[model samples]
Target chain A: MTTETTDAELTIWRDGRFQADEWTRAAEDEAVADGPAILPLERFLAERDALVSRNAPLGVSVEPNEAIEELAPHLDRVALVTLNFPKYSDGRSSSSARLLRERYGYVGEIRAVGDVLIDQMPLMRRCGFDSFAVTNPVTRKQLAEGQWPDVPFYYQPTGSTQQAEVPAGTRPWARKPS
Target chain B: MYRYDEFDHGFVAARVDQFRDQVARRLTGELTEDQFKPLRLMNGVYLQLHAYMLRIAIPYGTLSSKQLRMLGHIARTYDRGYGHFTTRQNLQFNWPALKDIPAVLDDLAKVEMHALQTSGNCIRNVTTDHFAGAAADEITDPRPYAEILRQWSSIHPEFSFLPRKFKIAVTGAPKDRAAIQVHDIGLELKRGPDGGIGFAVYVGGGQGRTPMIAHKVRDYLAEEDLLAYVEAIMRVYNLHGRRDNKYKARIKILVHETGAEEITRQIEAEFVEVRKTELLRLPDSEIERITAYFAPPVLAEKPARSSAFEAAKADSAAFADFATYNVTPHKAAGYGVVTISLKPIGGIPGDATDVQMEAIADLADAYSQGEIRVSHEQNLVLPHVALDDMPALYAKLAEHGLATGNAGLVTDIIACPGLDYCALANARSIPLAQDLSNRFGSPERQKEIGELKIKISGCINACGHHHVGHIGLLGVDRRGEEVYQITLGGSGDETASVGTLVGPGFKTEEVVDAVETVVDTYLKLREGPDEPFLAAVRRLGQQPFKEALYGTA
Candidate 1:
């Protein structure tokens, strides 16, 4: 018996289907890509002045334990912030995402990477994550078909403009439609 | 009693469909078992020792006759012939197959019930006082707030993936029947100094490897800011709570390391910011809409004195004993709350057969205005049983072995589904409970023991709530053999305290006798019979009890 499976290829997705891969990842020793480069958080900090002066959209990939406070001041200069799950069970990144949006008022994109599961996407969206990096085959298809568990009613407000996408007809924190 | 509106129905139906597809993917090998574990757990399906376990939430312990009847149906059709009511006011079917859970959830949704967050790392089913709406001493019905929290926390986007499982309990009355002190968040409904609706908020309380009583973070939080305040607390825990060590990750530890005063400041700052947004502000109209569902039911007026009730008590000593122990004062005139004890001598503490469930549902419909409640004590309650109908209700309950007259007495033990069913348990709690039950089975012995709570857990995760039991029995595995540890002077009421550990552990064979010795010692040294076990323990301390147990000098 044969089965289809996802490859090591990673594609950025926003507004549902897979989008253009405009962002390139830069390692510490690697040279920056021409257009937009997502750097490790530590690398971004070390190269803060040079990276910021280049005028290309910059993103920083953050680990779970790293303090989001480090990126707080740099949020305006940064065009995108990438958070890792490492494993989906690790929830620290969700907090970081919320802090970026709710606390720091970061308007740039927040993307989820690594071990991203379909079950947790709606929640990730609410934590101010606007895009996801999809490599899981089943998740890729599920997202393409718009088949995530959609709970329209909400009892809390978040920094992201989520309800606007689905139009839940709810006031802030109002679960029941009035 | 809160009927699901169109929004509620749509949400649950969609969730059911979502889970059904998830299950299908798991079965077809499209999803790995590792991948499927959290999803299944989010839907309240546990991969237990023998078979899969499904926990169905009875929110705030309130159940309609129809909802309970559906549980019975799930028990018979999808599981074994029985279900176990848990310490968190939920029902667990121990033997449901993974393939059949979607069907079971479908049946539940038909009755406006679903096990949305009964497990996983999410905020669990919010529990409240069992006699929430009907207790005579209640200042306000807590079910409304519980229902509100239920809606707010259901698949909560930001807070579902917490550091650990979080629990919240609310109590309407100051008596604290829900054991608010041992939960992650405990809300006591109280009128503020100006007589406005508010909650005395307590945070960081939990019972696990480490038992801590929640500190009163805010003495008077306005009702409108309930969700905002809780959101602030959740955010703090979510961000700062230790995820490196799973064992020390609960909010209790955070409160311990950071100190209560410091944590309270952080929470207040977050609360101030969140409250300004008006995101989760509880409008009076929404509160009123939810509160209306829990309003006391209208009933035909009758005299306070029921001649038939009096006659039955006089005629049958069994009925008299039941009336004395199992019945409590209800808020409404001529009404009483009836506790149908699932704890019978030598039987499991909270197992109810499908037939018993169906019969209790019938009784609720006929006598309780179709209302039923599941207490955290593992007993079923008929919240609005009239005095005129008490005897009749008692008679029907007796037919199904449901009429045990030991609501809070020695025989009404609280035990976890230990080694018999749980993968985490070190010993068997149910058999030990049965042994104690048989030892103190008689009404004479139980009445003499009087208002004693004997809570047993097979392990320290404290699902059995041994930390707050009046006489707590904790089973520990000593070099691979089960030995029990004894703790004294614990209470779960308004004045909650963790039990102090006494000297030494007892062998499994001797543990029952050890408990008996403790009880006998209480009986011997009490100031008077009027002084209950807890009061005497508090006054005398564990010195006398310890000396009696180990014959220590």
Candidate 2:
């Protein structure tokens, strides 16, 4: 796993294009700082009271199999939730992202980190992932140029607000395509 | 058949463009074979034994005359002048250069067809009863719901990367002609007590190495909750289905390990949350709109029986045999459903030549309201043919060598493209099927035997569906040579059950003899000539056949 220094300044793709990343992910056993920080769910739970006492924004990092119910009560305080994809084929994180957005109603920036590929970007975006931490240089460059393959229309309604462009009065639940 | 809307057209067109780009990237070495494999599979391209096999979805077995002609065109222009229709109601072109795939897809798109999700760890082609709209016993047509599911599961973001491939089948008739019992999810449309449409949902049924029948998850699910409930099932499977072992990754294993009641509880719990979301809930108007597209064609009611059809049958014995065995009663008056057997004597079961395809297409336009349906049993159905047109259609079909009057008899065998074409096969299946067809080639003898399903699988993958045949033959390799194991009493219809092993095994040459012995045993044990082989096997357990095969097992 490649690691970047906190001071190197990172960027993430959110909504449609690249933007400067806001929260910094704290290394293991690192103390909470004055700026926004993202910590693993285990570490946050271990030092919750102490982190809650601080005034800075806080977030939690979740693994593919981690339960979102554990993070539900703290959703109000957390502004970002990062889900890790250890491998591209292990798709547990996609379901976790949807659970956070649709089931738990967590209104926060859900970021996809690790092993994110250009082909999966469209799917991840549809599954309630608003931001992506692309580590692959080629995918990062592609994201920067907005050159990833995408279909403007979708068959299923997803976490995204975009509606399908079917005829009016055909389906009440259909979202009109923008 | 349901026509594609502008949205569906755009979706498939964009997918074609995306796949073209991916193919280019793979050729340029920007993507490795490992990376390109899944992408190509999602578009229904497979790396077969000899070459890339492209499987195109027929969308619940419904095809228009124009679409059938397009497939004929693909078979002639791009492939080896032939196409194989699969059990999933799809067509496979076994020989096509990878460079020409994009062009083939362009042709398919012109006819409102695609190969999307035909092969992959995703929701595959949604199959249904081939006699969907025209079956006399059907309560309601299931194609509309199948179409709805097709749209909902297409490129599903969350479920696309599942642990294993998923298959769903729907049937509106009480008879399980679609083999609903052997699918991951099987929906049986039923009318509620209050006269509203609902579904009897079955989950976790599949046929492979570990063959198991499905368990009913819901006795009745409202039609409006179809998408939400299906998504709920998918979500549960996506999260809890085992990713550790590829062999045990199907939802069947998960249902087996977790218990059906427990899985149902989880699905209901998930449904509580899923149903609340407007994104997943299916609206009534949408179902209505889809249902309108499949509305039965208007047919003028004629006399119940046709004089011309009877006269033709009386004049010719071959026509009489064809009419008796190959034709099914249609719901519309004076109309009959004709099943043109792809399994001619001593021929590949589902393979059709380009000329045969074009002939079938022309016959569909002339006799069946410009519609054709592919049966899961590897036959083609003209669902609304007028009885008066039967003689002409039969004559045309005979010219193409497709007018085999053995639809449900001994010669109507279903065999997968085994070692001859498939890389995963252990032994050749088509040869055994051909040998048996020759052994029982006589139409008189086939009629005497009556409605025997002999399904052969090349390997344990059960692609040939041997597990559900009345006399099933499973080809296995024994000490570097081909051997076949026989099973009896399997059926893939409303009373679906896996067959039981009759005895040990047989050499390739003796396998056909072994099958004959079993058929001869059934012939002796059957109460009357009217009793079918499956019924006889059911009446008397495997004991009689086992004794006949192994001398005292």
Candidate 3:
């Protein structure tokens, strides 16, 4: 009934925080230390059960609303949710991550897993992502770009205002098509 | 024509230096392609199908002859002898190497020009009616306001990374020649009841996969609050716009999702909040100062008609045809705005050589008021040419291959640099365009056909704007062979609509014949010669053309 989460576990664990600068299988394996193993969307679909960890559940990341039904139920057992942004130009993953959180009610740690840029962090954060798995091995200077004076300045009454300091009482995402 | 003050010059110089450093870092491998891709695109450099393409901004389509010559110089020195004038009224050099782009930009900076925000997901170049000042029906020249917007939006700290690219167009005339309806943000300049100039803002209109006419956002936004209102709209789009779907990222999609009324309300609320501070409104004197930069040139008092021009028109049929087709009415009485058609019959639409560019610049200085407008339709405009100077101007233009005598005629078609240049194209568009122009080359025939626009885009990307042509030809590669698709009855005016596809695709060689058949069908079906193909299509749907096209197939 009680779930335990720690700050140190989520801060920076991928390849000891900054080991491999590329998307390698070995690097990804080492990165997932806590809840469950994070597999690419393609691998999970092929052999979902076999890839599961002995101690933790297996979590898969898929592109936008592709197979939400299959991935939603596994969220209860899975601990880490990593979405793959195949390319910066490709935005399908961003939508998929949002759907996983808001529509399917996924409570696990959601992360942006690939082709991440410093400027995109603000946008990624606003789209309901809590954790970011930096794949590019960005320097400290690049990471420092996370500071914007006042982001989420304009709040839409319709969608998620997770990045903004919206009041807890008012749920922006709750408003349906009126 | 907004003169770069110390602040403007300082800002642009700093931006150029930053880009130059970025380029140096990229070349030295300090920055990889992954890292430099966004940076390069933000500065309007794209690694297209073949080599790199550098898009230089022609702010509001207004430039002094000096700036125009600099573009010509860039073409001669850095690029393949010619430059392509794009629909966005910018000049793009196709062959500039990645390493040389910074130098090219530096050269442009020397002429007070840069390619900032010409591409990428940020706000792109602000475009306006080519005949902004010269149009007879204009309430107020929209270029001054457009220039102000250009300054405001250029490398703005916020709204740099929008969900998608945004395009804004302005028109001072009620005739709507700028295709304002199809732009992401369309502004129509008009004088209010108080005699103060304001803008009619249209939102969410764009011409791509999901083409929609932008709904009117405000009846009138005061001239002073223009920048603030624009900022408010940009803020709304940046925050609320769908980031997940690239296709649904444009403000048009948001306007569609939330009706125009709701979007307008949101924008108005934001504008009110932002305008409370003095951040967005330009002082009346500042607007006047900007407007003074584009003040009408000293025009001599001359007769509206010259007997010599009439004699030349009568004696030389070629000159007569040129005068009839190329000349447009000017706001000034004794002057006529001339469009030096770059779409010469059987030639590339926008490929003016270095010499041609120089000639155009010289002609602008000598005949016009020292200002030249690069029309979005890919033609050079002599804004305030005296009627008496027509013969001399015509002679000069003829010598430089600029006197095509076809402005809005079928031969003066708009065609993108298709497969020949662009990497994304499915088939060649320029060649097809040339062939069609050749087939309809005769001035007598072109004049007989009257105002007809034939736009050809190589692919569905619609860079060539084929979707909005009266007779739209889209080239697609089928089974490793070039195939041309025809669309009929598309227009980008106030009543903007994407052309509907008609019948199956045609082979590369048969395209000219297909266009001929369509034109002939229109000629036969038109109420009269006065009824243009577009108007005919609008009055009576595409059934006639569709039947004529596929009746024998």
Question: Each prediction's interface RMSD?
Answer: 2.3, 2.2, 12.3
The total of clashing pairs for model 3 equals: 1
Going through the candidates in the order shown, the clash numbers are: 0, 1, 1
> For candidate 3 chain A, which ten residues in a row score worst on lDDT?
A169-178
Candidate 3 on B249-271: residue-level lDDT in tens?
Answer: 88999999998889999999878
The residue pairs in collision within model 1 are none
Can you write out model 1's per-residue Cα lDDT over B1-553, one digit (the tens) per residue?
Answer: 7988777888898889889998998999988998899889999988878988999999999999998888888889988799999999999999998888899999999999998899988899999999998999999999999998988888877788889999999998999999998889999999999989999999999888899999999999999999999999998898889888889999999999999999999999989988887767888988898899888899778777788888989999889999999989988778889999999889999999999999999999999999999999999999888898988889889899999898999999999999999999998899999999999999888988899999999999989989999989998999999999998878888999999898899999999999999999999999888999999999999898889898867
DockQ-based class of model 1: medium
Better of 2 and 3 by TM-score: 2
What are the per-residue Cα lDDT tens digits for candidate 2 across B216-258? Answer: 9999999999999999999999988999888899999999999
Candidate 1 C-alpha error for residue B434, in Å: 0.9
Candidate 3: residue B349 Cα off by (Å): 0.6
Q: Comparing to the true complex, what docking class would candidate 3 get?
A: incorrect
Task: Name model 1 segments beyond 4 Å from true.
Answer: A1-10, A25-34, A39-52, A141-147, A162-178
Q: Which of the two candidates, 2 or 3, achieves a greater DockQ against the reference?
A: 2
Error of 1 at B265 (Å): 0.8
Question: Worst lDDT window (10 residues) for model 2 chain B?
Answer: B277-286
Q: What lDDT tens digits, residue by residue, belong to model 1 across residues A1-178? A: 9644333443777887676667888977988988889999998888898876686888899998788889898887889899999878778788888888877888899999998978788789888898998877888778877876666666556645533433243333544322
The candidates, ranked best first by lDDT, are 2, 1, 3
